[model samples]
Target: MTSIRRRLLLSLFGLWITVWAAVALTTLDRSGHEVGELMDAQMAQLARVLREISLTDPQPAAKATPQALSAVGHPYESKLSYQRWLGDRLVASFGVAPVTPLAATIGFSDQEFGGARWRVFGLPGNAPDEVLFVAQSDTIREELIHFLTIQALKPILWSLPVSVLLMWLAVGEGLRPLYRLARSIGRRSAERLEPIDGDGVPAEIRPLTAALNDLMERLDQALAAERRFAADASHELRTPFAIIRTYAQIARRSGDPAERQAALDNLIRGVDRASRLISQLLILARLQGEPRATGRGVASLVRAAARVVADWQTDAQAAALTLTAAAAEGEPGVVAVPAAALGILIGNLVENGLKYTPPGGWVQVAIGSGRGSVALRVTDSGPGIPAADRERVFDRFYRPPGQAQPGSGLGLAIVRRICDLYGLRIEIRDGADGVGLSVLVIFPEPSGSPKAHPP
Candidate 1:
């Protein structure tokens, strides 16, 4: 894995090194140019002085020979050379000066003699026939240029380690906030789901902390729901299991055949009720486990209701109840929820109505599509729920008092969960003629093609 600190440090270090090298090279070039100009000026001035000295000597031009100059105390004296020429005969010379003319030109020029390159300045002497040349070795000039260049760059070169140290410190200080944020998050326990402190947080990391806080909040809610579900399941299952066991014991001990048969029938009904409770618990758990909204496709509410009504036809007949489904002509009743979820929503309402309604009552599943909504209504001629208790009925494992029907109480709760997931609106009211319970679910008009169906 790549580290942010290391990448930043490397980039800064490379940039510093590049700048240092550039500055050093520029200094070297500039120093060399300035040194060459200064040396040329000095050589020219010396040649002019020599010409004046020869003019003031008051000596014959061809016979005037000055004393031979040698190195005094300076290290550069040996590298300097001069020649005095009267009509091509060498009259006087200095350290390492050759007998021949340095150059044909009367200005500064470079020449090679005595196996060494020289920068020579030539000038006209006092007499028209006299000439003077002053030269310095190219090697001495080059050595001086290099020495000056190094002296100019000394400070920059010496400060490299200090600059690197300061840069590292600055980069570390800039990244300290990120390290603090990481440590703060690391110190948290799983149950400590509170939002992270936004104070003093760097702007770059705020979004990440916000997202993490949201996830933790959602996880906390889901965990609380699961805990409630487990408690309710345990409490609700105890009664049915005890009833079945009691019935079994009665059947085993009864002497009369008729008594035994009655006990067996009760035992079967108890087993069926327990089985249904378990099924509803599992369904509720599965529904709760899913995300609030999923990748479900649009489906026809009318078609799903009709199918559910057909599936429950036999059960309705056995219970001595009439079950029917209807939809207006040209009304498709399209809804955004998936077909399978629609099935569960309609199935739960229908089952609730059928379970509560007495024999000889009728249960109706109606679909209606209006201007901006598709509505599903399940009405049953049963004992209607009180207005005060209707809202409470959606709570898990909450059965209204005076309810005689055997049920898991999770049916309406499941229905409510489904509606909430897909933004469906539901209402519980009295049936037609105010005789029984009616559940109306309003779905927002769908806009997509149908893709899913109930299993």
Candidate 2:
């Protein structure tokens, strides 16, 4: 493939050659015609003046002297020659025209004298009996044009070398910034995510460097997240795996049915915990690139919470805890949400409430609105989170102080992902009347114009 610079140079070169060719041909045609006409007129004029030599006056050679030819032309430049018919014999000087051997002696016409061609005039005014002829060479026309072409082209041939040098310098100057950017990247370690120094960089290249820096930052985060995930997975998997191993050993040692049954129950509990942790991890993974709009009724914040709490109530009944939801009236029946995400949010909050609250204490899921945002509040009769740890609660695998619950710690991470996706805000605070923890998820209302489509 040809480079752009070479292609541009070739195009310019072709144009210059074409222009010079046209100029050469046009100059040759115009100058040749003008010079030829001027030469022909001179010859005619010379012939007329010579016919005034009166041979009938006895000594005509007196007026044909070299000084007498001074009125026609100089001796060196623009050659002029003459011929006279001295009694049917021809005379001549150096001329380019070949002999016109059969020309008639009319009043004014072309003729041949000696060995050269001539323009002649047979006159009856001054001498009724004589004819005169004169001629000049045509080589001066070609000589003048050839000299002009050489002078015009001399500078052009020399300027091409200078032009190429200038072009080389300009291209290097233009590409200097690109070379600097490459050098900056080349000097960096692969593990680093530091920003590029944008000072002295051109505005045209700033956007490219900024984009590369952004990509590096994201790569750093992704690597960190992967390490955290591996550690968290190992810790979570170790618990259930140990319980299964212990239960298997016990079942093998015990021959009685009752001991085997006890071992089976331990195995089941271990499996349940493992399953929940796996499900929560799966949720976090899915939420890495989760799609947001689930427009179903199940995606409603209050409804989803009510269902999750209903399930939690049945589970907590065996542990002497009460689970319930307190939905506000006159609120929109079903808000648009991502259902998988909303379920994760509602499930985590309600479970935390049930776990921390004492038996006979109530877990309330409330929905209300104020200040252009709708609120989903989960309040309970449990020890509330500390102000310092409240900010950190949404982190993956994080637990509040004095917490004893067996969890993978990914619950609030899932919840926070949902909250971020739905534009909802999460807060952990003392409940109304200062008894327990309150986690409220505030959602912004749709723009008062919900568009619909046929299913």
Best by TM-score: 1
Task: Name the runs in model 2 displaced over 4 angstroms.
Answer: 1-165, 186-190, 285-330, 333-337, 358-361, 383-389, 401-404, 420-423, 446-455
Q: Which ten residues in a row have the lowest lDDT in candidate 2?
A: 93-102
lDDT of 1 at 405: 76
In model 2, the number of clashes is: 1
Query: Candidate 2's residue-wise lDDT over 182-287, tens digit each?
Result: 8888887757668888999888898999998987787777667777777887887888889888998898899999999999898888888889988888878777
TM-score of each: 0.72, 0.60
lDDT of 1 by residue, 1-455 (tens): 99998999999989988988898889888988898999988888888888778766646445434345444668787789888887777877777866678889888888999899999888888777888889899988789888988888889888888988998899899898888878877887766767778898778888987887898788888988998899989999999999999999999999999999999999999999999899889889998988877336677887899889999999999999999998998677778788888988999999988888999999999988767888899999999999999999999989999987778889999999998888889999898898998899998885554434422
Candidate 1: which pairs clash?
A: none
> How does residue 260 of candidate 2 score in lDDT?
95
**C-alpha lDDT (0 to 100) for residue 122 of candidate 2:** 42
Q: What is candidate 2's TM-score against the reference? A: 0.60
